[model samples]
Target: MREVGDSAASGAGAGDMSAEVMVAGGVPLRRNGDGSWSEPPYPAVCANGHELGPYRVTIGVSHCRCGILHRTAQCNQCGATYYLPRPTDRCESTALDGRHG
Candidate 1:
């Protein structure tokens, strides 16, 4: 796993100091205020343009319901599976969409 950047170190506000870490397959997961990880609000799409679903995050891995690991997701549309890439940071994400304190 790799971290693209740390919001806290960048002088962000206290409520927006979560670090963004890049997991396997380049999928970027944001650290919650409680220290947990979660996917972005927008769904991730596979290379074939198929939408991925049922994104689940555990201890150190994120995956689909199919038991894939390391931020990998499977497309129910075309049965395609692959690692996800880090998405561009957005304003809303910096604040964790208001989900965290």
Candidate 2:
């Protein structure tokens, strides 16, 4: 049996990586015979209750001009965009410093 993190056996190298990998929380996703990735373990539904599937979602890496690597997902149904791991740090100042003058 192939061990976890074995990129060679899992076909999860640079070229073979899929968005399902991130959705699965780093677990290598299975590839179907037709070159499509299998569904992830947990459901990834948007706020609008749109389930993200192979056909209903588009996932990819976005190179922001700020030099940050952003793994993004877009719901094909409603055209909603998402930044994987969600940009929670944007409001860190408000969350961290809870004092107002």
Candidate 3:
């Protein structure tokens, strides 16, 4: 096998050449195979031209008014909308000195 640092150590500071790394907003951006860097965590179009989301929206429900443990997601095939029950336990950010119920 070849030595590990033989190549990297030789090319230090000239641009590592090992990998192109970029970190933003606690997320890592990578280079694409097409010689393009990825846009930050956002919606993107697919190869077939369909919009897709890399980020997600997480809804935490302490208790559902519908008496369900986890809220149900209503799928609208035509509109593609998901409706969840309202949250019962109210809470505010600890950074903002808000109280939790």
Candidate 4:
């Protein structure tokens, strides 16, 4: 598997990241013979043609406002983001600081 970039600074920094981080093509994607996306989370390519890496978002955080649990793929090349749904058991949601309600 090809590692994108320095994940620490590629897409996540401080509180900017909201999606869970996964490995590249870690979403059980199989390349179809037609060269199309067999599984959505398979080939995470950005609109700019940049390959997206695995990233996770928050799920059941203490005070998460997103409501659902999922992760996001961020392009290590162009810095773009894509949202993908994931099971809550897969990961935990990121808690928001100073959250109320």
Q: What is the lDDT of candidate 1?
A: 0.45
TM-score of 4: 0.33
> Any runs in candidate 1 off by more than 4 Å, and if so which?
1-29, 39-43, 54-71, 84-101
Q: Which ten residues in a row have the lowest lDDT in candidate 3?
A: 1-10
Q: On TM-score, who's better, 1 or 3?
A: 1
Task: Tell me the deviation in Å of residue 5 in model 2.
Answer: 18
State model 4's lDDT: 0.41
lDDT per residue for candidate 1 within 1-101, as digits (tens), equals 35455343322222464454445334556666566666654446666776555643212334333323333345666655454443233211222233422
Q: Is candidate 2 or candidate 4 better by TM-score?
A: 2
Task: Give the whole-model CA lDDT for all candidates, comma-separated.
Answer: 0.45, 0.51, 0.33, 0.41
Give a tens-digit lDDT track for model 2, residues 21-82: 32343233565545566533334886688999889988865544333345667888997777
For candidate 4, give the lDDT of residue 68: 46
Cα RMSD for candidate 2?
10.0
How many backbone collisions does model 4 have?
14
Off by over 4 Å in 3: 1-17, 39-101
Better of 3 and 4 by TM-score: 4
Overall local distance difference test of candidate 2: 0.51
In the range 1-101, model 4's lDDT, one tens digit per residue, is 12333242233322324322333423423234343323343344676786555452222213224454345555666655555544345344455553453
lDDT, candidate 3, 33-76, per-residue tens = 55554533332343344444433222233333333333223222
Clashes of each: 0, 0, 0, 14
The parts of candidate 2 lying over 4 Å away from their true place are 1-43, 88-101
